[model samples]
Structures are given as structure tokens and as C-alpha cells.
Target: MNNKTDFKTAQQFLVDNPDIEVIEVLLIDLNGVHRGKWIPRHKLQSVFEGDMRIALTGVTPDIWGRDVPSLCAKTGDGDGICVPTVRTLKRLPWLSRPTAQMYMHLTHQGEPWGYDPRVVLGQLQQRFAERGLIAVVAPELEFMLLSSERDAEGIPQVPQTRINGRSKVGGQLYGTDIMHEFADVLHEMREACDSMDLRLDTLVKELAPGQYELNQHHLGDALQAADNAQMLKRVIKGVAQKHGYVATFMPKPFAHVDGNGFHTHISVLDENGKNIFDDGTERGSQALRHAVAGLAATMSDLMLVFAPHRNSYRRFAAGTHTPIAPTWGYENRDVALRIPVGDPQARRIEHRVAGADANPYLVLSAILAGVLYGLDNKLEATEPASGGSHEQCRELAGDWLAATRDFEESTFVSEYLGAPFHEAMCAVKHFEQDEFNRTITPFEYDAYLITS
Candidate 1:
């Protein structure tokens, strides 16, 4: 494991940033949300001596930050410790005061936490390593920009909402002048990445208005790729706020625009640092096809991981690269999986399914699981289906009653995510669905309150 900076280094950080008062030790929970506690600068000394304690509810909570009472520690109960992942130490540039941040890994009684997303990814990576195959992953992250003006009550509100609001401001692919508003912040983000020593390849303004993408180039190990993906979000969000803007990785914040999607480009590499996808076979190697076949065959079953929410499913609408089906086409945006037209040396399958909101670890785990499934079962992608996953939304389990049926029915998912983790996720999601269903939105009241 790569852990940086012992107590001497950590204490030096305290001495170096004397103005800093708080340091947040965070961990990516099961839902991919960063959850942790704020510690005083004085605690920095003992960081290397031991781990930090956090509320147990974090591991099992849903994305809205809610946890089932039946499933988690009681309100104000503590359960485990987070061994500060020393390598993830970072400085927060957006806070009113100087602050440093670090991501954590959950452990209980000296064992990995069962519901820890990081653990899930870690174990899956080990499985891949055993097969003598490695995955290099570059997570393409997209997010929306919102003007920070709020209402009189200090409530937050997005200024330009609705279709054609921030959606159709004209697709400016690589329009730097237009993106100059965010340049200083983006540059600072670069500096922050440099400070933390995170490796990222390129940053570019994307197609949708106020949309941006950052690509991280890392491979030969699956867990590292996920860690990089997880860090990318944390770094960018912290840096974005320096420019008076709130950057969000929400899957579909707006109803009428191309929503944010995190396209993962993966290549199967050998121990010799060679790509297995290119064996010089006609139309690429069979391994490449089989890898994609594995993804396609199990796409729907992983919908809960890819889509993850009712709002997330909204992003799969036609026109955007997100595929409503499980189709694969060469550089075809219409397909669920688009094979980029380029040299085989850089050949990779662009998974167009994952929402920007999806958990990086979960997303990679699903992909790794699918690829491993293919390698293990010798699955072939002979009959690629078009629009393969629209059925996920169509068959909604009638109000969270059976939403996970497809994935639950999938023996492959059962094998990949393991039964316990899968059950935990499905249970949490069902609770979320129940919460949303019970709430009455303004539309319901406006449409029926006066007329009904």
C-alpha cells in the first residue's frame, strides 16, 4: 500500500500551514459520498499513531445522507475507526479559512468494513490481479455549473434552470474563451492537483453549456484508478468553489440538457505493460470483443450502479451519448458503448452508461466484475443488443417494490458484488424510493390543490 507522510510529515503540515485549524478525515461511503469528521490541528500529531473514529451510520446510509434505523448504529452511537489514508492528504482551497483534507478507509476491530465502497473495489482489484490481467482506467467526469445567487431567505437556487436555460447555450466544444470565467479556478484546480500529486491528463470544457470534463490517466491497477477517480472529484470540487461557483457531479441536475456522464475508458493490460485488447487480430483482438461482450451482457443488471436513482435515469434520454440500450457501435453516439475510432494502441471501450452521480468505486467494480465474468466464463459478444437497458426504467418494480429484480435475478451480479453488499444497496435504495414516493412535490399541489 502507498501511504505517504508519517507523523513527522503530518506535524510538518501543521507547522507549515499554521493558519489552518481544521482537518477533515474523510471516507467514501457505500454511496460514494465523502463522510468523515472534522478534527482540530492538535490531533494531527496522533494521526500516524492511530486511526480516526466516525459514526457507523456512514457505511450504510443512502445518498441523501439518510440511514435506515434498523440497519445502522443508533443516533449518537459510534462503531469503528478510519485509518487515515495518508496518501489522500489534500488542502482545501475553498474554505473561508485554510483547511486540509484526507480520504480514509473504514476498519472495524482491525478488519475491512463490510459496507465500505473502497473495500469492495479493493477486493475486486485483487481478483483481477490474480488473473494476471490489469485494468487501466481513465474516468471522464462531467458536471454542471450553477450561478450562486440565492433567494431572500438565504435558500440556494440555480439562476438559469429549465430546458434552453443553461442547456442550449450552444455546444462549445473546447471553447476556452467562453470558459474563461472558470479558467482561474480550473488553473487553481491544476495547482491543487499538482500539490497533492494527483495525475490527470487533460481538462476541457464539454459539449453542454457550463459543462466540463477532466480526464485522469492511470492504469495497470484497478484500485488506483478508482482512488484517482474518487480524488478527482474531491480536488475539482474544492478548487471550483474558489471561483465563487459550486461544482456538482449530479447526474442530471437540469431536465432539458445533456446531463453529466462519467465515461470510463478501460484497457486490459499485461504484466509486460502491453494491452491485451490489441493482439493484431482482424478488427482488434477477440479479448477486446469479449470484454465488451461481458459489459453488454450484464449492463442491465448493473443499472442500479450506473443509473442509481430516478433522476439519474433521466439522463439516458436520446441525443446525448448515454445509451438507453445495450448497443455497441464504432464511434457511434447512439450506442450504449461507443468504440472510439483511433489507433488500436489506444483502443478502449467507452462505457456510456454511468451517470456523473454514480460512485466511482462502484462503477469500476461493476465494470471489473463484468470483465472478470467474461474472462472466467469465456462469454462472447456475438449478438450485441441495441438499447439494451431501457427495460430497467420501464420495469421500475412499481415503486421500489422490485426495482432490483433484474440485478437480483442476475447471478452474475450476485457473484460480482457478492450477495450481502448487493442486498444492502438494494435495501437502502428501496428506502430512498419510499422517501421520494411519500413526498408531495410542488407540481402535485399546484395541479390538484385548487382544481381537485
Candidate 2:
């Protein structure tokens, strides 16, 4: 519960919108799942100054919401205090009644929660601050919009275009026609974005049918940038549902089409407010090279952070836009680390490794950690990966199990994410892997039932 002194934003928001019927408090878990409770308007005032208790295991649950006994669950299955961040307060325009939502941060013993992803990122940010530097970041998130109706097999299908009221039949990358076709829903999305304070900048029609990308405005506060990404995802999903469509951020929603990606664009700034990655050259400054080297060195070890789930690994198939190797290049989309063609003052590294399904907090933390490591060690990168990176660079873990194993064995992960989070995350992933392995798939039935 928030206390009166700390609930200024909430109080003002209520005063500004007297008709609000409910307030939803949210806390994001390790898997990027938002968990919370809805309170009536009358009860909102009491929660502001009070601590809202939630089960600690709620933040560590697997995709199926099963308990991983090894992860904080065995410690009496306790509760953690969820404190709200007032700046995250926003109204849900899609809801029938006016409803407001705010994000929360978990804590224990009056200290920042060790297992919280936001806390981990904040810890890393402090490290940068000590070095008189700040990390500026923006995220490009891709997702697919499907019709709410399912086929006979209960499989999802792309929603029909608003203009033609028919399914899109072909790839239309950057097609203005596709944008116009979804104008009604997109217009609602834009309006909602404004109401929510999510700095959504651009929407592009992607290569696959029903696939699109949304880019957020860059901000020097990495955590706020991540918050924007998370909120934007919620806004898109909710608005789509209200428009009679299903929106998905799953990395590989369709096996035959392009997958969703969460590309993070990052630039470093010195205390003097100058872009550290820019030294008046197109090749970038020495700091930029160091950052790239750090990212490459940790690519394999941090694969789990970039692609967390079994479905996430499916997006990395060759010939896809997904990256196959830990390589960097300027104005090249074929490499994992791309220096986009932009103004010298805006020079930045675009990390294209993370899937849209990845946790924005963890993804940014891993990327920043690598950058810091490279700067500290003054590491050097290999020659730029031109045309393609596969032949010249080492690949990230190829499978989900392999990725988790690499993450479990990484000293760097332990160093940056803290030993407890490392252990808890590994335990959770191992549990999820075991559960997945035990389930029989349709492919298995098709192949083995007839032959064996």
C-alpha cells in the first residue's frame, strides 16, 4: 500500500478523473508477466501509504504457473511488499469504465528486492553512474495481430484488413496500403498511447502478414525506457482485444513467417551530455568498439536472457531476420550488433539479439553489463562482419536447453545479476525444461505412432 505522503500522483490523478471506477496495480515478474490485483476507487486511498503484499513465488512462476520449489518457494512460500511507482499511473481508455493502472516494485526487509528484474537493472545503472556515464536506450517491438476467431483446429489466423475485410495474402514489408487498412485500430492505438504517456514513435508494416513493429522514443533513463516498452505492449494487447482482434508478442507465432523481435538501440552519454559513442567518425568512437566487443564476448553466455522460452528459440532459424552470430557492422542488418545509419550526434548500437518475448528489464541489463565490461577491460572486437556474420563468428546457443546450460555456467551472469538471481533463474528454467520434455507433442505422435 502506498502511504499518503508518497501518493501525491495517485491523489492528483483521482482528483483529475473522478469517474474512475477501479485501479489496477501491477508487478512484473521474471518472465515478463504482469501480476496484480484490481481495487475499487474507494479503496485506492488506503493502498497508497500501505504495503501491498504478494506471494514471492508469483514472480518466479513458470509459463504454466507451476511452482519451482527451488526458487524462493521453499522458504516458507512468503510474501513481498509491492510498492507502487506513481509516475506509471495511467488510464485505460479501452475499458468500458474508467480504469487506472500503475506499476509496482517488489521489496523485502525494506531494501530493493534482489530477485526483481527492475532492481537488477537499477544496480547496473548505478555502476554506470559511478563512471560518470548514462545509458540512453530505445526498443523496437514487433508483434502480430490475429483474428479472435479460431480455425477448426483452434489455430490462430491473421485478422482481415479493415479496408478490404479480407486476410492479407502476401508479404507487404513497408506497405503503406497495409497501414491504411488497419487505420481504425492503429488510430485508437495512437490515441491510447497519448493518454498513457507511452512515447510511441513509429509503426511499420513488417515482412509477414499481420506483423508490425512499434518504436519508442529514446530516453536517457534506461529503466523508464523499459517501462515504456512494457506499457506499450499492454496498451497494444488491450486495444487490440477491444477492436475484436488478438495481439501476440510471441517470437515465432508462425513457423513459416518472420518472427517478432525486440531490438534495443543504445547510446552512452558522458557527464557533459555528449554522446560517448560518437567521436566525429562514421566508424564510431573507441568506446563504441569496446561496447561491441563486450556484447560479442557475452553473446553465448547470455543467450537465455535474449531468448528465454522454448518457442523463442524457433525465431533464430537461418535465413530469418534473426541474428546467427555475435558480430557487429555499420548499417548492416545481417549482424547482431548494428550501427544504424544516422546522424553522428545520434550514433548508437542497435542490439538485435533479443526476441520480443524477452523481458525488457533483463535484456537491457545484460546489454549494459556487457558494455560496461568491455569498457573496463578495453576489449577489442574482430574485423567488422560484412555482408554476413555466420562464417566469421561464433553462434549463440542453438537450443533452449543449451542456452540455459550456458547461462547457468556463466561467471559473468553471476557477477552482474547477483548470485541469488542467477541460481533462481536457472532453477526456474530447469523446471520449465523438465516439464516441457515430459509433455508429448503432436509431431512426436505423427512420426512415432505410425513408424514405431
Candidate 3:
């Protein structure tokens, strides 16, 4: 389905949604940030006439929106042409104003910008294509819905009542009543998803109070899956705000509760449209094993993408559902890589390491790259872990600093992701770390003021 949108398609979209007053052309950056411009309805045609001009450094900002001067993003912050991706053209049903949005990719001198997350995923997909394979992917995103208002101390609090007037409580995992509690919000979210062509599969109540999980329908095109994941986050946040709730995808929102996880399920298919992971038996095919082996072997090196933020590591505690070891098993939730029990044709590897906050493009890239690596080298996986995999298990880096350091030093990352991307990502992370270190936390002030 080569659904690349051109100016004629954009014109048709404008004609169909004649009420739309504006268009938002968004480009996903290396940090997974949506950077773009808004064009008035009258000028929307110009967007398709040629590439939209934007500062090349628009995609290189840290979380604080600080630019990395080392990338030369500040040589007058020169303009890069942004080409609109037609497949992403859709109406945002949640917005009150008549507005439309489209995803975009940036290019300089007609070559894809290496730092663009969308470009990164597209590049990785090409590698799969070269091997006569296609990866099917789905990302199950978990998040929390909180009251828009904060507490006296300015901490976020879960809403006390659902639309049904029931008090919000914890440990409501898989409870139907909990789903009913947020029925209106979820229904509206579904409407938004349908309007935007986002294939949302399920919504479930999570373990924490006001926590929820939404699984996307598996996409045969892994790149589109990442694009949908990114768009879904935007939709959820937008819809939640309209419903007077604050939606958060932060990995660890509370110290005592379970954290949000972005678990990905993947399966590869051959040129003839046959499942390469299925050998028509209980045990998956050799290709599946090789994919698992690659994932397990490279898990440590890719921790930075899975757990990107400082608080991301907080989800990896002993009792948390998050995996602390690089292990695999059949239908085992305790292991990092689980081969879910399902129909033989539907067999796939569920990668459970990434947090809800990680960039979908980077996460998918790391996973696909690992699978290719395993297949290229015919890597072998260790025995499946029966119980908790932590015992005698290889632990992921204990903290963000260690994880980022490992990523920066990894030859595999440099080779597969390309050195320019690797260096820029590492530089941005290091800048963030340095910026964070300069901040004096309340705990530091209290501990030092009187005792020291």
C-alpha cells in the first residue's frame, strides 16, 4: 500500500473537510517530540506545492527544548524542507476548532535527515526489505489519567470519581467496572481514533488507580505502527484534556504504584506473505529463536532507548512487573522476551522492556535491528526462564547514566543506527543529564540545610 500523499490528495482532503480552518504539519524529532507549524486554511495548498521550510535544529532539541550547538543546528538554525506524509492526514475529532493534522519527514538537499525519528524507522524498515522480510509490530501503551487540578504540594492526583460517581481506587486490574468508570472518555478517544484511522485494539484497567492500557491493532508495516503509537499518544492527551483530565505516560508516576509500560509485539513475514516465525508446531520456528536471541543479546546495549528518562529506571524494582533481566520464555510475563501462546500462524515475540515514555521509533528500531543482527549472525538464545528471571540473570544498567554510557559506547548502535544519530542522541542525553545535575532538589536542600 504505497499511500504516499501528494498535493492532489491534500487538495482532496481539504475539499472533504471543508470546515477545517487550519492544518498542523508535525515532524517527530529524535527526542520523539512533535515539532511543526500551523498553516491557515487558505495557505494549506502551499504545503503540498513544495517542502515546508523549518529550522534544521527544530528536531534536535532536548526535553527542555535546548539545542545542541555541536550538531551545527545553530548555523543561523538553517532551514530544512519538510515534506508532508499523506497517510497521516486526518481530522482531530477531539479538538473544538476545525483543524487537521499530518505527519511529516524532514530532508536537507533531498536526503533524509538522520536525526528524524520517522526517518530512522524508515531506514530500519529498508534493511528488513533488503532481506526479503517485513516486520509486523504493535505497541501496547499504558498510561494514567489524573485530575487536572494538583494537590496543595502541586503533586498530581488521580480523579476521585469516574463519570459514574464511583470513587477511584487502586488495584483494579482487569475490572470491567473500572472501564465503565471512564466510558465517556474512552468512547470519545475511540471516536478520535476512528476518525484518524488509528487501529486501537483494546482498553483495559491497569493495576494503579486511574491507570489504563490501550493496545493498537497489529500493523504489518512496522513504521506505520510506530507512527500510530506516536499519534495515539497525542490523541489520548488531547482527548483527556478535553474531558477535564490530565493524561500522563510517565513510566513511574508514583513511588508506591506500578509504572506504565510500552510492551511491543512483533512477528516477521517473508516475501511470499507467509509467517516466518511459525513452523506449524508449539515451538516457534528457527527464525523466531534467532530473533529472540538477538533481542536478548542486545537488550543491555539498547536500554537507553527502552528506559530513556531518569525516572524510567524506577520501574525496574524487584516486585515490579517490569523485567529486571534479559530473558525469554513461552507466554511468560516475568521474562523480558515472551513468546505468547496463540494460534500458530499468529505467533510473535512480545518485547516487554520499553517504558511508555520512550520514543516509539527508537524502540522499534532497536528491536528490528536486534532481530536482523540475530538473523545475520544466527545467534542462539539461552534456556527459557521458568520463574522470575532475575536470579542469575544479566541485569540491565542500574541507572540512566549507565544506560546512556553503554549506548554511547556500543559499536552495534553506531553501526546499525548510523554514527550521526548515535552521536546526536548521546549528546542530547548527556546535555539533559548535565542540566538535571545543576538543579538542587528539595531533598538535597532539606537534607543539607539542617543536618550538614
Q: TM-scores across all candidates?
A: 0.87, 0.95, 0.96
Tens digits of lDDT, candidate 1, 1-452: 12344555676777778898889888887778888778888886555555567765677787778777656633344667676665556677656787888777777777776567887888888888888878888788898666566567554344353333554655477877766656677788878777767788898878776788888876666777777788778777776666677788887766776888988888888778788888664366788888888888788788888877777877866466667666776666666677776788877788878888889989999988887787777777764444433332332222123436676677776677777567667777877878988999887988999999
Error of 3 at 273 (Å): 0.9
List the candidate 3 regions with Cα displacement exceeding 4 Å.
1-5, 73-76, 162-169, 389-394
Every candidate's lDDT: 0.73, 0.86, 0.86
Winner on lDDT (1 vs 3): 3
Can you write out model 2's per-residue Cα lDDT over 25-69, one digit (the tens) per residue? 888788988888998877776566655788776678887777788
lDDT, candidate 1, residue 396?
A: 28
What are the C-alpha RMSDs, in order, of all predicted structures?
4.0, 1.9, 2.3
- Give the per-residue lDDT of model 3 (tens digit) for 166-192: 444465788888677788998999888
Worst lDDT run of 10 residues, candidate 3, spans 162-171
Error of 2 at 38 (Å): 1.2
lDDT of 3 at 96: 87
Instruction: Show the lowest summed lDDT stretch of 10 residues, model 2.
Output: 162-171
